[model samples]
Target: MAFFPVFWRILAALITSLLIFHRFSSAQSWDPGYTFMHQATTAPTVAFYDYIIVGGGTAGCPLAATLSQNSSVLLLERGGSPYGNANITDLAAFGAALSDLSPTSPSQRFVSEDGVVSARARVLGGGSCLNAGFYSRAGHDYVRLAGWDARLVNESYQWVEKVVAFQPPLKQWQSAVRDGLVEAGIRPYNGFTYDHLYGTKVGGTIFDRNGHRHTAADLLRYAKPSGLTVLLHAPVHQILFTSRGGTRPKAHGVIFTDANGLSHRAYLKRGSNNEVIVSSGALGSPQLLMMSGIGPIEQLQAHNITVVLDQPMVGLGMSDNPMNAVFVPSPQPVEVSLIQVVGITHNGTYIEAASGENFAGGARTQDYGMFSPRIGQLSTLPPKQRTQEAIDKAVEDMKALPQSAFVGGFILEKIMGPVSTGHLELTSRNPNDNPSVTFNYFKDPRDLQRCVDGIKIIENVIESKAFSSFRFDSLSIVTLLNMTASSPINLLPKHANASRSLEQFCKDTVMTIWHFHGGCQIARVVDRDYKVIGIDSLRVIDGSTFRNSPGTNPQATVMMLGRYMGVKLMRERHATNGPK
Candidate 1:
């Protein structure tokens, strides 16, 4: 009967409820001593810490937790904890989490100078708390190029995985994408593995079976509770320097502000080879560096910041891997899925697929108590108005979902790849404002060409025999530039002007995956050990340290780097009786 499909969906939800109730009953409380908020404004004006790390985000959380094992550590974050936020914890509200423009939302939305829409995570867990939850390791060649010990990186991946990663159950739509990738020439489907391969493979995810998400903040469970002090709503203002006629300006401490407008100074404890580490994501790291007068000489002078160390590449050559998507519509209901399968193109491009919820309780927030009063206060909008607004927004956001209850029963086949680099720079000295980002997407001729090739590869997969059953009368590729779907056949023609049309599409519709990287790097801003070249007792560890985007989802890379830096710093600390 026509109602049978509805009955099955309800049955699934009932089964899922039992699982959720069980999980809630058995869940244990996280370590309490490791966390603090701005309300606990009791921090002394001047406090000493063996390692004072600014930005308790993706890299910061894990790194601070690891480093706190032996030494006293202070971790400061600009955003609140993601632990209790239902919008963040429910995997079903994944899109809503990013679409949320409220300050309280984990993601901070922004537009690049060149008009590319993007966002950054401002929560304690960082990007892992906001991203699409796709997890994959960096390309092996990238690991070797960075001169990182492979064994160590492997161990670091395991450590993060045990806490947050899960094997996604491949359902209908995801399985189709997997076969399409293989049939379209992305051969050798690796069943289930985290190793980066040049074919269709099922990678790990952060969302669990019942759709609960565990963030990098969950890794704090491994922290030395007594040694780690995590202060929320504490944003670092500037890095304090003590020259004392030293050759290199030594970073002695940091000046930051707690939420209640209280100023606090966290200094490296004397007698310990103590230091300050900036793990404040890509944009925040360089901005903080420049604010402390460690960027380009010209920019520093323009901002009236006393030049401590002029590093020209401090905020230059930022690259946000450009992204394009192809939405394939279907009448059949497909189960909701995050990134379960990915196709690694031969030419630095990565293709993945996702399906929207066609099942019951698709409205995650309404069903799961995500209507937070805090979000309305942050957005400065009326409460019900905000709820209604998000619901209206979901109509558009849920298009990639399967067709049963929620609309847009379609399989979203997306492609994101790296090309020429861009830049991220400070617009001003105010840390409260966002930085000036220029993704420079498709600015280079080669980049445009790669995008066209990527489109062609996706088209081939859509037309392949594997996907012949789910025929698409018209394919619409959505970008930041377009409002509605535009057919691929019309966009990519075999006519004389086909090249021109495709080139124009790549230019007009090119958008970013918000996967920005390399505003600061090893040879550019930091040295081999991730220390700023011209500064002493300071280091930068985050996505900014990446020389280039790894051509896959960078969350895994971000967490991996955090884990690597954490383990590496601890080794050096113990070996040298403290940091060098």
Candidate 2:
């Protein structure tokens, strides 16, 4: 692959083996003191900890590790570990993890009530194990809006950066995307930086120079391992609470199930400060809250779950950043890459790209899985599962693609700070099943307009001189109803039937970048300290707390929040002890 920058012949050969096999031996180096990590089946029927955190994902992993520094903590994850999973640890197989729809896969697929497809991380490292490794800090304005201690936020971000973030070496395809963004007037090329600035810039990635991913799970290395217990395949069923003489229900423990369907009860150590933290993603966190009887009275009543707290806002105000993209099938082979270069516009849009991924329908030559396509509409949907009807419809629409559409690159645009929002509701009481979530993409007129603007910019980026070499203007994918068109390398369709107004295009093709946030938001579900309102000894420290998506990607900030809040909780604990 001449597309990649020059490297040693031996190293190149090793990388090829790693990518092909989807495994890396080097990932086991951190397991020296990881004796505390185990499968949920191995856990005792009853246990006690100073803190019990649900969902050992992007935030939960780091939060548990940090809290364990001074407190005995238990981190529960519904999915298995990410270690040795080539689809997760290898950079070349970027989308393979999400594409995997197996019962044991780290990524769990879900379709919203709006018919949009997305995934949630069920693995120990969370989305960081499944996402395209792009790492950029939350913007300064976002920190100010969240009312975080700026200095501490910076410190937390740096701590995470040191463990997982890395400067990526831009390959041929990524370099072109960067040039095209500037050519299209996205302004000052900020070289390389982690700050979420407006303009084209090279941000950090979690994939290190060795082409190996280091997830938030690695943050456990900094933890006092003896004090922290991590159990995998432990899906928390419900949070247990106790009420004292008319006061709010105080969360004291939780009931979770192991892989064998056996129940286990874990309680907080006997202390008023001991707490239960929910760091599940936007979908899981709120779903868990509602299952625990802390949502709207009507919802709880309908589900037959006894209401512990009639908090109407628990599952309200959900927002997903709607994305639209054009696929460009290069006549010549392009270098394989994930998101490394980004174009951040002041007009609430983010432009990004990934190249050389093989979509099952597009490139019949290979089967990386049905979800390998970088095209948002197809890749994010549940494959032959709960939304089989929707997937069948989506695949039927994909039949319009020319063979050229399958083997190329994708240029995607995402709307930031989307004012449009929706809500999540439970379909079943089963904690393992995905809840009914409706992102209501582009519900706000302004959000739809931003999508239009973003599409126009993407069209410009494709037409720019920097991107001309990869453009195949004649190729196009026929329209899918309310679905983003798949291919138009030059952003122009030679077939008249494939053409539509930009606004209509935006409406029809809207998809998700999986940047959904805002179910359990501040001032609604949780307080400034992320403590759940109307409840005691419970907190939510995940993406669900945000009013908006923090930056180009929320993973970086999400991980930072885990560390930041963990430190804050520790400080508060120390203050209460007063120089023990």
Scored by TM-score, the top model is 2
Clashes in model 1: which pairs? 318-422, 356-401, 403-409
Q: Rate the local accuracy (lDDT) of all candidates.
A: 0.68, 0.78
**Model 2: per-residue lDDT, tens digit, 1-580?**
3321321221112121111222235533233347789999999999999999999988998899899888999999999888767777776566667756778988887878777668888898998998778999989999998999999999999999989999998988788889999999999999899999999999999998777888988888888877899999999989999997898899999999999999999999998779999999999999999999999889889989989999999889999998777655566556667789999998998999876533335333222422333222344333233254554444443444344444457788898888989999988788889998888877789988888778777778777889878765543332221123332211122233333666766765566778898889999999999999989999999999999998899999999999999999899989886532
Q: Which run of 10 residues does model 2 get worst, by summed lDDT? A: 10-19
Give TM-scores for every candidate, taking all chains together and pairing residue i with residue i. 0.84, 0.87
Question: Whole-model lDDT for model 2 versus the true structure?
Answer: 0.78
Tens-digit lDDT track of model 1 for 72-101: 888888888887676677775555566577
The residue pairs found clashing in candidate 2 are 22-86, 362-406, 482-508, 483-508, 483-509, 484-509
| Residue 101 C-alpha lDDT in model 1 | 70
Alpha-carbon runs more than 4 Å astray in model 1: 1-40, 357-417, 473-500, 578-580
By summed lDDT, which 10 consecutive residues of candidate 1 come out lowest?
Answer: 14-23
